[model samples]
Target: MDFLERIKARKSCLKACETTVTTVSGHSYMEKILADGTSVISWPQASTSPGYVIDTKPDLQVAHVLPGLCMGSQDVAHDFGLLKNHSVTHILSLGVKPVTLDQMLNYTYVQLLDLPETNLISSLDQCFIFIDNARQSGGCVFVHCNAGISRSASVVIAYLMRKESMNYQQALMHLKNIRPVIKPNPGFVQQLKDYEKMIFTLDGK
Candidate 1:
């Protein structure tokens, strides 16, 4: 099926599923429970579009993944004061756009969908370049998506695996240690596994 067809099918599936409001850590969000017992978290407001699942409460927490790398939700990305405080000189927006463009910070926007089937591997090379450029320039990069739970998390995990010479599990565990809330979709997890294999192959390891 084509992309649009797949999106239509997903929307139909979501519409047919049972959704409930659930609270965790004092934050409320919609959870769509599928027939297979898989639950997908969604935004508080009604929207089935990809990248729309944001926390109801403003998430200002930014986890410092590395010396010059940080991960956060769009809320923190949009907050000028928070970004300034973090000394963020570059912003990597995944699957979401900033409210306004800030001239002071370098921006790299990647068009990604918060879906299992979304192809993040193809975009990783460019993302790595953008991130490394900021770090090499004595600047920090803030990576974020709608909620910093899926797309952005996957990118950071892939970055760690490649840059730090770690395996998928090692990268994930290290990231989870710093940001426990990150949970990449199943497809992204598999892709990261595939990426690990590819990396080893290219290195002849």
Candidate 2:
């Protein structure tokens, strides 16, 4: 199946699945049983309420997309030590719950879902302002989502395309060179292409 077909299949599968919330040792976990009898378990970060489980560790990996701009997973954003080490003073959180860290750091939270149908372009202007403000103030900005794969990667690519005057393909290629795991969903890719045209029109190029 092609990309759109795959997306449709996945969406149908998701719609057909049954989901349940269960608490284990105060941590809430979401369990989904697909139509095909495949079970999937996920830790719902927002279910933890005021804060998340600090003990649940994820691999500490961050990729520098630009001089002062970096991209990583939600875990890297929550890690105080990692933020300090990277000198990340601003955070652009996409589709993930905000973690309370320090008063010195700034955060811009966008309620984005990591679904292909989600409109990522509408959030780009706000995100770009946050990133630009951080860069102007000589502070580093770390952009992240759940897995640092789709949502966050698309944001970074959009930033590069807008600020650097690079096309979608060029920006995507540059980011892929730095972070090979970067892969924006098909819907996001189409939106980015639309954004490029919008930019060109505004620039009279």
- Model 2 alpha-carbon miss at residue 115, Å: 1.3
TM-score of 2: 0.71
- Candidate 2, residue 192: lDDT: 92
Number of clashes in model 2? Answer: 0
- Model 2's alpha-carbon lDDT is 0.87
Each candidate structure's TM-score, on Cα atoms with residue i matched to residue i, is 0.73, 0.71
- For model 2, give the RMSD to the true fold: 12.1
Error of 1 at 163 (Å): 0.7
- Cα lDDT tens digits, model 1, 40-71, are 87766543444334547898999999999999
lDDT of 1 at 10: 74
Q: For residues 1-205, what per-residue lDDT tens digits would candidate 2 score against the true structure? A: 8998887787666544555564554556678777664688887664544333464568479899888899988989989999999999999999897797998999989999878899998898899999999999999999999989899999999999999999999999999998888899989999999999999999999
